[model samples]
Every structure is written in C-alpha cells, then in structure tokens.
Target: MKQPNAAKQHKPLWTKAFLLTSLSNLLLFFSFQMLIPTIPTHISQLGGDDAQVGLVIGLFTISSLLTRPFAGKALDSLGRKHVLLVGLSICALTIAGYSYMAAITLILAARFVHGIGWGMSTTSLGTVIADIIPAERRGEGMGYYGLSNTFALALAPLTGLWLMNAYGFLRVLQLSTCLALLSLLSSLFITYPKPPMPFEKPAQRPTLADRLFERSALLPSILLLCTAVCYGGIVTFITLFGREAGISNVGWFFLCNASMVLIVRPITGLLFDRKGPEWVLLPGAFFTIAGLLLLSYAHSEANLAAAALCYGVGFGSLQPALQAWTIARAAPNRRGAASGTFFSANDLGIGLGAMALGALATYCGSYAVMYRYSVLLMVVFLLIYGWCLWQAKRVVRLFGRTSN
Candidate 1:
C-alpha cells in the first residue's frame, strides 16, 4: 500500500494539458519566427529607409516591454485562459493585418500591437506550463517544452524565406496568420488551473511592486540577463562577422548550433535536477566563452561550425536551467509574475546588447573585434554568479552564529 502511494505521488509530466500547451507554444513561436527575418525586408520593399526598418524592431520591443508587467498581473489575478485567449486573438488579427498594410507606418503600428500580444501570450503559456508540470520534474519538463522553440527557430526562418521566394510576401503573412489561429485553437482545449487566490486578508491589498514583478525571481533572472546579452551579440552580428572573415556560407553555423542544442539540453536539464546548477552553469559559461573567442577569429566554415556547437552547448544549458530555477523560487501564486520578470530581463538584455555591441563593432572597425569584446559580458556573468554564492553562504554563516 505504501509503495502504491509513493508511485501515485510521482505525477506524470507529459499530461494532455502540457502537450496542448506545448503545441500552442510551438505554433506561436513558429508563426513569430517566420516573420522576424522577413519583416525588415518587407519594410525596405515598401519604400522605407534603413532607419524605419530598425524602428520595425524597436517599436515592437518597446510595446512588448510595456505590456509584460500588466499581462503578468492579469494572469495571476484573472486566470490564464482569459489572458491567453485575448493575446492569441490579437496575434492572429495583427498577423492578418500585416498582409494589407500599404505604408511603413501602418506596418510599424501593427508590429507594435503584435509585440504586446507576443509578450502576453508567451507569459501566459509559460505560466500555464509551470502550473501543469509536476514540481519534482520541472527542469526536465521545461527542457522538453523548450524544444518547441528550438525546432521552430531552426525551421521557421528557412520555410518563411522559401515561401517568400516562391509566392511573395503576402503568402508569408497569410500562412503566419493561419499558424497563429491554429495556436489559438489549440489553446482553447487546454484545461487551465484555477488562479491562485491571495492568502492575505481583504483589507491587505497588494502593492504596485507586488503586481509588477516577482522579487524572489530577480537573482536567477539577472544571471539569465547576462547570458542573453552575449546571445544578442552573436545573433545580431554573426552573419556580418562571417562575411568579414571571408566566409560565404554562414547559415551552417546556425544549423550546427541548433543541432548541438538539441543534443545537450535534455542532458543538462537532468543534470540540473539531480546534481545542481553549479554543475551545469560553470561549464556552460566556459564553453560559451570558448565559442565566442573561436568565433572572433574564425575564417573557415569548419571553425564557424565548431564555435557554434560550443556556444550552443553553453546557451542551451544555461537558459532552461535559469528559468527552472526562477520558477522553483517563486510561490505558486506568483509564477506568472516570475515568468514575466524572466522574459522582461531577457528582452532588455538582448536590446541593450545589440545596440551596445553594434556601437563597439563600429568603433573597432571590425565585427570580429566586437565579438572579442562581447566575451567580457560572459566573464561578468561568472563573476556575478560567484558573488551571489558567496553572499548566500555568508548569510547562512551569520545566522548560525546568531543562533549559537
């Protein structure tokens, strides 16, 4: 009887709800990824200058940042279904709207709205996954869930580009809109958990800070931000860097990177659950640093592939580990806020890293040199993590002394 009870306690991670949510997440990301590489080209074709092309991304980022906190608040207070449905509706409509926009300004406006929906939908999806997955298997569950994104990233851009070449831009938008609608449809079937009611008395209303962010999640989120910064530099400039190095086929780098990530993520996730973050993080950072340094000097496809594989291992290990850590630290009621905080930090880091590293590349007169400097960001990540550990130990020691 006791053995049966113990077996029952180990709830399955791959439930129907989890699968539906993951499917929805996969479709959502696939639709969004297909648009990312094509949108700038669309703006350029519509008589927009380079500055306006940049605004297409910039305005979207700003709107997403503005919407995330409120989305988080709504998810925790109003429940997941409402926020998820509203966000998916906005995404589907905005994607369809993109097909009809004639002017650059209209496209930019639509992109901004799309970002708001992106932020809300992503946050809600993350919270829903957290609610459904078994606590003990969270790292493993998140690893599997994130594969949807990895597969989308690897396939969507290529597919989008192919569609654009064959049928033109309008077809791309129509297909992306259809994908968003399918994502929305899949989401409707998910049985969401009830919203976690506040434990505080009615008179004790939540504060502004309470509604905006999860305090317990900040530490791991900071570490995640540092990694995102390095990632931003890579994704933004790697193609240019390859050209600067006299390499023609830079696409191979992403293919190798994605392959390596697919291999390492599940293993790293299991290690994080059983061994601890230190087992994954230190080696992950080392691999990332090695990858960046190699990439700075890579002049051949083989070298580029090697660098990509190394970076893939590092980033693939770090991202899900930090996210699982963030979710683990937060109360059940605050998981939505925690996910929002995690994503917000990631967005802030990427935006800042791109802008700052672009300036560095300009100043140094070489994208290769810019990558060399980007390694410093990862170094900072390791240092900050070490300091956090020391602080934790010191507080523990002081408490022990006081008790004595």
Candidate 2:
C-alpha cells in the first residue's frame, strides 16, 4: 500500500508523449525564432524600410489573433491530432514559400497565412501538454517543456544570422523551412490524450464567447499580454537596434538571454510549485524592468549581455508561471479555450507593441529611446498585478468577516 501510494505520488511527467511533444515544440520554435531576427534584415536587404518591417510582424500577429480562437475550439471539439496536423502542414508550406518570393506584398500575404498555422499549432501543442502533464507537477513540467523554447532561442538566432551572412537570405529561409518540416514530422508521432468530457453531451452548443476564450484564464492572460508587448518590441527591432548602438554581433544577446533562461527556468519552476507565483512574479518583473532599463543604454556587447541576462530571468520566469496559472485556474474541459485565450492575448500584445513601438521609434529616430519607452508597459504590468493581489486579499478578508 505504501509503495503504491508513493508510485502514484511520483507519477511520471516526462512520458514518451511529453518528450515527443517537447521535441516537436523545440523544432517548431527553432523554425520560428530563426526567422524572427532575420526577417527584418531580409526586408532591409530588399530595400524595405522600418515601417514595412513593422507591418510584416504586425500582419503575422493579427492573422494569428484571428485564428487562435477558432483553433482552440477545434482542439476541444475536433480533437488535438487533426488540428495539429493541419496547422503544421500550413506552417510547413508557408515557410517554404518565403524563399521563392521577392516582393514585399507576397511575403506579407504569406505571413498572414503563416500566422494561422502558428496559432493552430501552438494552441494545440500547449493544450496537449496540459492534458498530459500531471496536475500536481504542472509547473515543473511546463518549465521543462519551455526549455525547448529557451534552447531554440539560444541557438536559432545565431544560426539564422550566420546562415544569412554566409550564404544568403535564401539559405536561411531554406533552413527554416526544413526545420518546420522536421517539426511537423516529429509531431505526427505523438500520442495525444483524449479530450476531457468526451462522452458528456451538452444541453446547448457553446456560444462563440465560450469557444473563443476562458473567463477563468483572463487574469494571467492579461498579465502575460503586458510582458508580451515588451517582448514584441525586442523581437522585432533588437537586431536593428544593435546596429543603431554600433554593436557588431547582436546575436550574443539572445545567446546570453537563453543561457540565463536555461539556468533560471528549473529553479523558478520549483519555486512556483512549492511557494506560489507571487514569489516568482514580483521579483521577475523587477528584473525585467532593470534589464530593459539597462538595455536602453547598452553600447557594448558586455552591456548587452548583461541586459539579456536580467531580461531572460524575468521573461523566462514569468511566462511559464503565467501559463501554469492559466492552466490551474481553468476547468479541465476548457483547457483548450484557455490556451487559446492565453495565446491570443499574447499575439494581440505583440502586434500592438510591434506596430505602436515601431512607429514610436520612427518618430523619435532612436531605437534606444524606443526601448526606454517600452519600459512603461512593464511598469503597467507591475501596477495591475499588484492591484489584483490587493483585491484578492480584500476579498479574502471580507469573506472572513461574513463568516463571523
């Protein structure tokens, strides 16, 4: 009896399904992250300006925003494997198309379609992970899973840039397409868990609101959105900003960021599991704020690496913790919707940040100033999160009084 109880207590988190899923996610992110910094550079090489670059990122995110809600519903209703396959196919095809197109308009069109694939694939993968991971060890499992993204971040940008510099943008695009194909292939082998409540029939079909979003997941989504705005700014413009600051190799920043994230993720995950999000989020936010502030002034590679380290810890810690929070707050049956809501919010934030901050950079004529301005969003995040905590405490106290 004691052995059985201990075995149940230690239910495996790293099952074959989880490993395959993580591998799929890693490869997908490698494809995605490899393109992120290089795309803006590609546009520049094609005689496109900064605004065009912004439009490219914005359009991709907007299309993703449009697709994620529907994808979430499909994950719940249609099942995970089919939705994942469809999404991966779309991603693979669209990514391959980039190498053939020279016109900005064609690339933009492709980007819109690519966003749909990204929305579906990411939402399905996240939902599947939530389904498979044990409830008790969700934070830890998510942390480990997110290491894929961290590793991708560590290697993808540098690899992409190197390929682009050595051979050409065509080579970079070719490699990215290959990576996407590999990710798609890897996903085909995963054994997905059945959706919760498969046998239960509802009295009424779900409304659009019910299909699109989960109310329970909103707080964490909102919190995630704030940080994502800042993230969007970084992802879209950091390479150009590196040039503006006269740094020869901006790739090192990603390397440093990923390195720090690799170190911080496990520790933060353990802390989140043992203590709570508050223990991680508050300090994480501070670190992010400091990192951004430091980045605003970074002129040397060392300074850039320092900024990345701080930002990495903050961003890395906050993301998984928020994801875990979203999953924990949601009903098992609604996990798909919750994942969609969370990712949709993330896309929206990134879109907004890319568009708005890109314009701001244009207006100010300085990337450094733009980064400094982006720090305000993080400040807003901290304020809103703190207010939520205070409100929660007040509600608890009121409940105590009512009980008396």
TM-score of each: 0.95, 0.90
lDDT of each: 0.88, 0.89
Q: List the residue pairs that clash in candidate 1.
A: none
For residues 32-113, what per-residue lDDT tens digits would candidate 1 score against the true structure? 9999889998889889998999898889888887888889888888899999999999999999998888988899999999
Question: How many residue pairs clash in each candidate at the backbone level?
Answer: 0, 0
Candidate with maximal TM-score: 1
Name the lDDT of candidate 2: 0.89
RMSD of each: 2.5, 3.1
lDDT of 2 at 139: 82
- In candidate 2, how many Å is residue 290 off? 1.5
TM-score of 2: 0.90
Model 2 regions lying over 4 Å from their true place:
1-5, 40-53, 102-104, 198-206, 243-248, 362-366, 398-404
- Model 2 scores worst on lDDT over the 10 consecutive residues at 395-404
